[model samples]
Target: MVHVYGPHIFHTNDAEVWEYVNGFQRFMPYKNQVKTTSRGHVYSLPINLHTINQFFGKTFRPDEARAFLERQADKSITDPSTFEEQALSLVGRDLYEAFFKGYTEKQWGCSPTKLPASILKRLPVRFNYDDNYFFHKFQGMPENGYTDMVGQILDHPNIEVQLATKYRRSDRLDAIHIFYSGPIDGYFDYEDGRLGYRTLDFERFHFDGDYQGCAVMNYGDASAPYTRVTEHKHFSPWEEHQGSVCYREYSRACGPDDIPYYPIRLVEEKALLAHYVARAEREKGVTFVGRLGTYRYLDMDVTIREALDTARHYLPRAAARGHMPSFLEKAIAC
Candidate 1:
C-alpha cells in the first residue's frame, strides 16, 4: 500500500466534522504562522496588522491600521469583477504586487486579471494581531500523522480497501450503490474535452536542522519559479526529528499523465464541466462525490462533511431502492 500524508490543517465550523476528526485521538493543534517571502523580506500572510505596519514601516494602532488600508485601497475600482481588480480594491497596488500577483500567477498558471474575483474573497485582511492563517474555531493536524490515522480508519470490518487497483469504465462491480470519487470527465471518457487543472511537482531535499522555521513558506516573487516550500517535519511539531525534509513545490498546468491538484474553473473549463454534469445526470446507478467527482476544489473539512452527508443520503435511498441524487449540486457554480 502507498501511504500519503494529509498535510492540510483541519479547520472548520462544522461540529460534526470536528467531532469525527477528534475521535481519531491524533489531534495536534497549532496556530498557523504562514509566511511569505518576497524581495528578500518575510511577511505574515493574509495581510494582517503586523504585515501592514511592516510594509509601510509605521506601527499604526487598530483604528489607524483600518484607516491606512482604506487609504491604500483603490477607490477607482468601485465595482471590481476580476481578481486583479479585487486585490487593488482591497489592498491597493503595492501589497498586491508584493504578495498576490506572482503567487497567484504561479499557482494558477494565468494572470490574476484572468481569474474570477471570487477566488480572492476567502482571503481576509484583518486589522488585529491575530496571525493565524485560518480564522476557524478548530485548527490542527493528526498527531501520529494522517497516513496512520487513515490506516486506522480503513481497519474497520465493514471497509474493504483494494490498493493499487485500477477501475476502468469496462469494469463492473456487484454493489447496491456506487460513490465515484475519481475525475468526472474520466468517467465519461472525456467525450467533451478534459477540464483544466493545476498540478504540483515537489522537489524534495533534506536538511540537518530546522529549515525556514515554518510548515509552509510561500515565494511571492515573479522571478521565483516555485510557488512555496513546505517543511514536512514542521507539520508534526509534536514529534522530534534530527533531520528535516522539505519540498520546493512547483505548479504547472496539468496534463493527461499528471495528477490534478487544483481545478481551473475558467470560462472554457466551466463550459466543459457543464457538459459533463449534464451527462452525469443522464447516467444511472452512480452518484458523484468529492472534489474531482464534482469538478470543484474542496478543502479537507468540506470534503469529509460532504462525504458523511452523502453516506447519510445514500442509506435511506439504498433501503428504499430509490435514486441518490448527486450530492454536490452546487459544483457547477464552483
Candidate 2:
C-alpha cells in the first residue's frame, strides 16, 4: 500500500507492542517541546506558569499564581459545558479567545463553543514549570522512518501486496477471501448519506538553518490560517542534517470525494458507522481494518496492536468454523 499521507509517528505505553516493533526496527528516544504564538510572546505548550507570567506581564509566586488565574476565570460559570465555557470559567475570556478560539476553529473548522468540551480538556494550567507536551510512558519515532518499517512488516513471503490495485467486492476470486482496507462507507457505496470528515493540507518549505527553534509551532492567533508547522528533521534528533524539511498543517472540511484524514464522528456519523458495521456483520468473507478502512483516526502503535490482535483471534476461529479467515471478524470484540 502507498503511504500517500505524510509521516506517521508510532508511540505506545504497552511493553508487548514495543517488543513487537523492536523486532523490526530500532527506536530512538525523543520528546516534543512545542512553542505557540500566544498574544505575541512565544511560549511553551500546555500553558505552564512561564506562559501565564509572560501573557499577563507579571511575576507571581506559586500561591499568587493560583490567585491570579482565579481572578481571570469566570466565577459565575458554575458548570462549564462547552470548550469556550470551560476556557472562560478557568482562564478568563481574553486568554482563551487569544490562544484557543481561533486555533480550535482552524483545526476542527468549527468554533470552540460549538465543539465538544472533551477535545479541549487535554490542555493544562500548570502552577509549576513542567513544559513536557505529553505524559505518556513511552514516546519516540522510528529510527529509520515509518515507510521503511511498514515495508519490512509486509515483507513476509506468505503475503502478496498489489500496490495500486483498486479492488471490488463482487470481483471473482473463488477460493481467496478479501481483506479490505478501504473506507467502510465506500465499501457499501454510501447506501446512506455520506459520513462527515476533516482532511489536512500540508505546505512544505525547505530551510538552511533551523527555521523554527522547535519541531512544532502552533499559531494560536485567530488571524493565522494554518494551525501548526512541523519540522521533520527535528523529529529524529539522533541524526543531524544541514537542511531541514518542515510542513505547515492546514485543516479543512472533507468532501465525500476527498481523501478522509479524520472522521468527524459526531452523533450523526456514529449512527452511520453502526449501519456499515451491521452490513459488514452480514457479509462473512470480508474483513475491514486501518484508519480509512474503519473511518477513524488511530495512532500507529494502536493500529499495529489492533492489527496483530485481529489476525491472531480470527485465524483460529475461521479454521474451526471451516471458513476462510477474515480480518474483519471480531474487530468490535477487541
Candidate 3:
C-alpha cells in the first residue's frame, strides 16, 4: 500500500505492538523540537520556559517562573470552559490570541472560540527549559522510512494487500474477510452528511543550508499564510545531507475531492460517528480499523497498538470457529 500521506512516525510504549512492528522493521531515535515565531521572537514550542521567557522578556528561577505564570493568570474563572476562556484565565488573552487563536483557526478552519476547551487541554506549559514536544517515554522515526515499514507490515505470507484496490460491495466474497481503512461515511456512501476533515497542502523548497535553524517552525500570526514548516531530512539525524528539503504546511477544510488529513470530531461529527458505529456493529463480513475506519485522529503508535489488539481479539474467535481470522467479519459480526 502507498502511504500517499506525508511522513509517518511510529512511537509507542506498548511492548506487544512494538515487538510486532520491530520484527518487521527497525526504528531510529528521533525527538521533535518545534520552534514558533510570535512578534519576531523565536521560541520553543509547547510554550516551554524558553518561550515564556522570550514572550514576557524576563528570566526567573524555576519557582519564580511558576509564580510569574500564576501572576499572569486570571484566577476568576475556576474551571476553563473554552479555548478563549482557558487562555484568558491562565495566561492572559495576549498569548492566546497571538499564539494559539489564529493558528487554531487556520488549522481547523474554525475560530478557537467555537471549539471546545478540551481541544487545548493537551497543550503544555513547561516551567523548566525542556522543549521536547511529547511527554511519551519513547519517540522516533523509521530509519528505512515509513513507506518501507508499511510494506514490511503487509508482507506477511498470509496477508494479501491490493493497492489501488477499490472495494465494490458486489465483489466476490464467498470466503474472505475484509479489513477496511476507508472513510466511515464513504463505506455507506454518505447516507448522512459526510464527516468533516481538514486536509494539508505542502509548499516544498530545496535549500543548500539550514533554512529555519530547526526541524519544525510554526508561524503563529494569522497574517502568515503557512502554519508551519517541517524539515523532513532532520527527522532522521543519523544521516548527513549537504542540502535540505522542507515543506510549508497549510491546513484547510477538506472537500470531497481532497485527501482527508484529519478528522474534525466536533459535536455534530461525533453524533454522526455514533450513527456509523451502530451501522458497522449491525453489519457482517467486515472489520473497520485504523484512523479512517475509526473516524478519530490517532498517532502512529496508537494505530499500531489498536491493530495488534484487534488482531489478538479476533484470533481466538477465529480459532474456535475453525476459520481464519477475517479482519472484518469475525470481530464485527461476533
Number of the top-ranking candidate, with lDDT as the measure: 1
In order, the Cα lDDT scores of the candidates are: 0.84, 0.76, 0.75
The candidate 3 region of ten consecutive residues with least summed lDDT is 325-334
Per residue, candidate 3 scores C-alpha lDDT tens digits across 1-334 of 1122555556666777767777777767877788888677777888877777778778887788788878777888788777777877777776787689878888888877777777777788888889888877667676787778778878889888767876765552754556678887888888877988989998888889878777788888888888988777677788878788888889999998999977888778888877778887766667788778878777877787777777777678676764333233232211
Report the Cα lDDT for candidate 1: 0.84
Candidate 3 clashes between residue pairs 3 or more apart in a chain or in different chains: 286-328, 287-328
Kindly report which residue stretches of model 2 are placed more than 4 angstroms away from their true locations once superposed. Answer: 1-8, 61-71, 74-81, 171-179, 322-334
Tens digit of per-residue lDDT, candidate 2, span 1-334: 1122554555578888988888877877877787898667788878778878878887877788899899999999888878898899888987897788889889888777776565667778888777877666777777887778778988999978777776776763553456677778788887777777898888888899888877789999878899988877878887778887888888899887677887776667778887777787677677788876776667777777878887786678667765644334444322
Q: How many residue pairs clash in all the candidates, one count each?
A: 0, 1, 2
Q: Which stretches of candidate 1 lie over 4 Å from their true place?
A: 1-6, 331-334
The digit string of per-residue lDDT tens for model 1 on 30-76 reads 77788999989999997899999999899999999999888989999
- Best by the TM-score measure: 1
Ranking by TM-score: 1, 3, 2
In the predicted model 1, the residue pairs found to clash are: none
**TM-score of every candidate relative to the true structure:** 0.95, 0.86, 0.90
